[model samples]
Target chain A: MRYLVPLLLSTLVWWILTEAAQAWVVGVPVILVSTWVAVRLQDTDSGSAPTHRLNWFAVPRFALFFLWQSLQAGLDVAKRTLKPVPDINPGTLYYYTSIPHGTARYFFGAIVGLFPGTLCTEFSEDTDQLVLHVLDTDVDIALDCRRLEREIERLFKLPAADQQGRPA
Target chain B: MNLAFDIVLGLALLLTALGVFSSKDLFRAVVMFIAFGLLLALVWVRLDAPDLALAEAAIGAGLTGVLMIDAVAHLSANTLQNDQRDDQYDHSPKRPLWLPVISCVGLFVLLLGAIRFRPEASVSLPDMVRDNIAESGVEHPITAVLLNFRSYDTLLEIAVLLVAVVVAMALKPAAEDRVHQPPPAHDPILHGLTARLLPAMLLVGMYVLWAGSYMPGGAFQGGAILAAALVFLQLAGFAVDRYAASLLRLGLALGFLVFLTVAVSVMIGGRPFLTYPEGFAGQLIFFIEAMLTLSIGLILFSLFSQNPPHSGAVGHQGANHDQ
Candidate 1:
């Protein structure tokens, strides 16, 4: 029962990797071994770590929003760096996030760096503070971070924490 | 136009090589060396050898850079403690420039002459490979050549890798200190990236191994990707090496053992050393490659993991020290 998700995923991976039928001769053993390894690794953490449950229905919306944001941010960065004098104001901002300290918050930190002028350098779990380095400190980075946090919360269907209304 | 691009690339490659050698800071030199590897990969691509390009980029640029940076970090830390000794060592290092210049020029001339006057092979090896590729049991000529035509070479390569890894394991410092150290503080960013990227990396490694049957990918490339994924997991504070020590030892040698077993087992059927039985060649090659990928991945990861972790931390500090 513990191996179901990993086994299914590994088999799907095997199918995708080698579409040929004959490959299953070796694929079967490989998939089984891989699943065993995965299950073992998962067991290493015990029950303390939260298993992330991604809402498939929300992925498309999140991905599209992410892609658009990244494109705009990338262009903004290019413009800032390629300028004659390199117009920029760089500083750090600490974001106290409401998103819990699991995969969702971690993912939020990862993608936040891709947004225009923002880089997530550190995340303090106890404080739920995401330390961000931004190219232009003048821009309101907190607003975008809050909006993105909400987007991730929706994607994960995480229980709404009452902290969203808390001051940024 | 292509010639122009190649010439520019060639120049850039030379410049990066110079940068690597001439940089005052070891960290910068390592960075330059990485750039040199990338440019060399580009050169391989331009020469229409995507396989070499992938290997060069992954192993030469990526893995080697990390190793070298780790080494540089160790050196920096040592120098910090032995600052006076380092100054004395630096002052004593004045070798005459003309000696290297003369030797380098002589070596270049010798290489040029060798290229100009080399005799053609009596047998056209590529032609022979092309003609018999179908018999070798794989669609890709490179795969067929590697796994079938010249399998002795491949066998020896795996053996060499096994020997190298065994040596690494033997030379590693006491494991007690590392085992007792606290797990790295959980950083949401690293954990998040690992969660997302690890699966994709594993998938790509498998895809590359599978693609070797019909394209410019193979066990080596796939293995390197797998190793990179393992390294990434370790970096993210997952001590996989600690959890699966016995399994990892088996994995480290499984490919070589499997290859050797198959090679010798074939002789019992009255065929020559490595010639797979007529129709079973494809399946056998696939099986060997699958094992080889796992073994190679584990072997490479072990090499990186065997190093003391603090040496790598020192390398990080060295980068900041330079800046």
Candidate 2:
């Protein structure tokens, strides 16, 4: 029962890769072995613990939000770079994140780079601080970081109370 | 139009080669070399050799790029006190410069002569390959030639890889030096990427291995993808090598052992060495390829992993130095 999700996923991947029913001769063993390895790796890596589950229902909403933000931010950066004067203030800003450590926290870190003008460069777990290099530090990056963190928290189904991640 | 494209590609390849040779910065040279590998892969594709293209891109561009960058990082890390210069590591006594020039000119003339006066072969190699491909157990001519007609060459290639990896293992730094280094801090981004991408990589590796029976994909390409996945996991701070040491050692030699066993076992059945029994050739070849994929993947990954982490100071920045 514990291996059901990983097993199904591996089998689905195997079927897709081979696309022939006869391939199951080799696929069956490969799928089983891969699922076992996945289970083992997850067990050893605490960050990938199964407790934090992604809400599939919220994925499309998050995806659309992410894509739109990335497109806008990408253009913004491009416009700045293409200017004669190159209107930009390149500086680093440290922002404390409220998302707890693990896959969700990492997802937050990953998406922070795509947010407008900010690229997460150094993430200190002990301090819950994300050192971001921004194209224009003049903009209010805290608001954007909080909003993105909230979306990721929702996507991972963490409780609202978990926002007080490490007490500053 | 095709000729024009080829000419442009050739020029670009030469330019990248020049960039690689002329760049003062080691990092830039490595990057240019990677570009050269990609262009060479394109040339292989234009020549109608998808198999060579795949192998070249995966090994030459991808794996070699990572290795070269890792080496450059190691060099820079070791020489932090000195300015980064092209000749910082050139400690060898300077020899006569004309030695290289004469050798290069001599080799160029020899190659030109060989190409201009190449003899006509008595056998129509391609037609012969086409004729025997049916009996070789695979539809793809390259796979047929590699596994069936010229399996000895493949066997020796695997043997050579095994020897190279064994040497790497032997030359790896002492465990005590590695033990003192701090474990890389878990980066959520790299961890998440590895978590999501690993299964997909495994699937692609398997697919490429299976596709060799009918297309350009094969053990080498599949193995390289698998190795990349392993390296990704290690870079993401997973202790794959520490946990899977015994299993990895077994995997590193499985292909060669299986191939040798099959070859010798078949000889006991009054058949010649490395020749599969008539009807069982397909299954045998597939089995051999499967083992080879795993072994090759492990071997390549070992080569990368064998290098010691540069120093404890660079542990915080996990971008280049790996344990």
| Model 1 residue A153 CA deviation in Å | 1.8
Clashes of each: 1, 0
**Measured against the native two-chain assembly using Cα atoms, what DockQ does each of the candidate structures obtain, in the order listed?**
0.38, 0.51
* RMSD (CA, Å), each prediction: 2.9, 3.7
What C-alpha lDDT do the candidate models reach, one value each? 0.81, 0.82
**How do the residues A98-130 of candidate 1 rate in per-residue lDDT, one tens digit apiece?**
888766776777778788788988777567777
List TM-score per model, in order: 0.90, 0.89
Q: How close is candidate 1 to the true structure, as a TM-score?
A: 0.90
Interface Cα root-mean-square deviation for all models:
3.1, 1.7
Candidate 1 residue lDDT tens string, B67-182 = 88777777776677777765553243678989989999999999999999999889998899989988888998888988999999999999999999889888877878666655
- What TM-score number comes out for model 2? 0.89
Tens digits of per-residue lDDT, candidate 2, B209-242, equal: 9899998998889999999999889878887767
